[model samples]
Target: MDETSPNIEADAPPALDPAQQSLSEALRVSFGILKIVMVVLLMAYAFSGTFSVGSNEVALRLRFGNYVGSPGQRVLERGTYLAAPFPIEQIVKVDTRPSTLLLEDEFWFETTKNDSGLTRSQLQFQKAGPLHPLRDGSLITGDSNIVHAKWALTWRITDPVAYLTNIGSKEVAQELVTLTSQQGIVHSIARLTADEILRGIVNREQMLGLIQQRLDDMRTGITIDQVTLDKVSAPLRVMRSFDAVTSAESDRARRIVAAQQERARILGETAGEASEPLLDLVNAYSQATELEDPAHAQEIETLIDTALLELKINDSVIGGDVARVMNKAQTYRTQITEQIATEAQSFSQLLPQYQLNPRLVMTKLWEDAREQILTGDVETFYTVPGQLELQFNRDPEIQKERQKEQLRSQKKAQEDAESNR
Candidate 1:
């Protein structure tokens, strides 16, 4: 083991005896010498602290259980290497490549959170899983129900040493994961109702999140790619009711969606009503711009007038013979105009007469018109210009009828808006 051992050379080649020596013999001796030299060189090479690493592989040099070198230094890139002698150091090869593991656990019992919220309640009715016992998973659902669950955990070695320290070994990791994954899945399952597990959607991402959180709390350096819902079966007693509730839920969802759509329709009408004034304001602004372009004033005013007329028509609740109401308004306006025109000339001649006894004629007319406009005679006195007074009659039935008509109109206006959109 000393350095001097390599320095010592083998004995000089023995002298060839002339009688036994021949061409082949001499040559053989020479070849043997060369072989010995080659061997010596190989031995020296072997002790030079060299190793090999494949293209997809890495290596670590350890001296007395402590890391001595990085993954590869004197190691071959993708070929053979003659490592240092055993007493000096050793090499450990690790395949830094992608790999997969299919692990599973069968948990017959479930650990659940207890009502005290301090300790969890284990499902004594359920049986313990075969892999390992996961002690800290308990959940209660919206509906009262409990069930045991187990799971499979597939993981990879992200950090070899960490994995070693955390999960111990791949086999150990699988075992721990079998127990923990089962526990986690059961915990989640127990927390949910049969409907949530059955009809409810268990998102893969959420499941993974739950799994990863528990693993992190335990400091297990692992990542969950997915958590598949393998099966969801309800307990016997409420199974039938659960199935019925599913149908009712679907019907309820449909009703909700329909209601939402109706609400949207109503909202569209409400928004339209609010926007109408904006439209009018824009038109009015355009009309006010008449000072900027006198030539366009008539056009702007025409647009405003058209918009007002349209709005008025829209406000009138026109549908099926709505033209009649519009015609009535127009006719009433025309009659008022005609009556005023005729009365204007008469009023000029009557101004002086009215100045003297204006009340006399109008009082007489009002008295006579009251009889026609009213019912169930009630009389009234009036101060007149040409007479002592004029009598007036009022009727309660007519007044009540008018009041009823007003109330009906008010209710009709407030009942519901006409759909504008």
Candidate 2:
């Protein structure tokens, strides 16, 4: 049986060689390893499409140069997404965050990089030559005045697909936005006066709106968040003149405010809260007078008088100087009326008494008048009936009393003056 087995083995391809067997085994293991490596490579190739979208960014997947998925699903927001690998598909990420673009010297006078540190005077001294129209950038105002400005623009990609399709990249979008904003600024500043621009009267909101409109018209898929005028000024040659004009305008505005304040104060002191209505009446009356309408003027005057009367009668109404004057005048009128009536009554009674006895009444009246004259603060001279010569020199005591009276009058005048003040 053993001899037959050997013969059969010898016949079976003369038995496989050890080296060949080992070589065959190694070939099998290598093939299995190669298959596993191929599977891993395929998995790697498939997962290579995985991408992360940032919180502030949107992603668009394009397959064969065309966007994938429906219109609404095309833009991928903050998350992980997978698409076919390159050549078959492309992942386009768009930053949706607000991007700032500072446009400096675009509308400014021609200046080199070294001129940045120069002051206005230094720059003016260095560039003393006439402006180069081609080199210099400027905006013409409504007043036919030239001005320079620096601007800052904030923008964002609102429509990712549109942005990716139309503008393509942030850099290209920024360039387009900047160019459009410049055009918008030119159009906007042209409508404003030089003084308005230099004095910060630029309508940035309007400028931004116009720029956004322009972007929309161009289908740029970019929206302007803000347009800021960082700096604006007239040409260096006329800057001082513009400054002077600006200063004069500010002074004029200040004077107008001061005048308004003074008017308010005066009105408040004249009639308190009623000052506004009183002023309205006064203004209407003045206007009527200027128009030569006497009837209207008279009507306004009557209304003013009525308002004044009501203010005086109603104690609840806060009265100012006008009310105080009216009260004083009314009080004086009452006092004078009472005094005149009492004097008239006294005169009437005396007339009847005088009619009853003329001589007696006359003597009595003379005595009463003499007594009144003696009681008054007057210098009285007395004479004896028989004495022909009277002493011309006054008494020392009387001179002393007169001096004392003069001192008292001076002191009383001083006190009255102080009280009035």
lDDT of 2 by residue, 1-421 (tens): 5554556545665667999999999999999999999999999999899999989988888888888899888888888987888878988888889999998878988888898899998976777676778998889999998888898888898998788778887778878988898899999998999878888898888888888888899788888888888988778887777778879988999999999999988876777777776777789999999999999999989877877767732333536677766666778999999999998998788898888988988898899889998885556787878958866766688788889999999999677544432
Question: What residue runs in model 1 are displaced by over 4 Å at the alpha carbon?
Answer: 1-19, 23-60, 69-144, 147-154, 165-169, 199-221, 225-231, 236-238, 266-421
- Angstrom error of the Cα, residue 237, model 2: value is 1.8
Q: lDDT of all predictions, in order shown?
A: 0.55, 0.83
lDDT (10s digit) by residue, model 1, range 1-421: 6865653345556677776678778799999999999999888867677666787754555567666545334332457666556666776664545444332214233323452243222222232233233643233444665433333345554444444346644566656655566556655665566556675455556556776777777776556665655444343334456667878989999999999888656534533333344345456667667457655666656654554445333343222122333444677989999999998977787677777887986886588778876644443445757757545567678678788989998886555233222
Q: Which candidate achieves the best lDDT against the true structure? A: 2
Q: Under the 3 Å rule for N, CA and C atoms, how many clashes does model 2 have? A: 0
**Which regions of candidate 2 fall more than 4 Å away from where they truly are?**
1-48, 82-88, 112-118, 203-206, 288-298, 312-318, 338-421
Top of the candidates by TM-score: 2
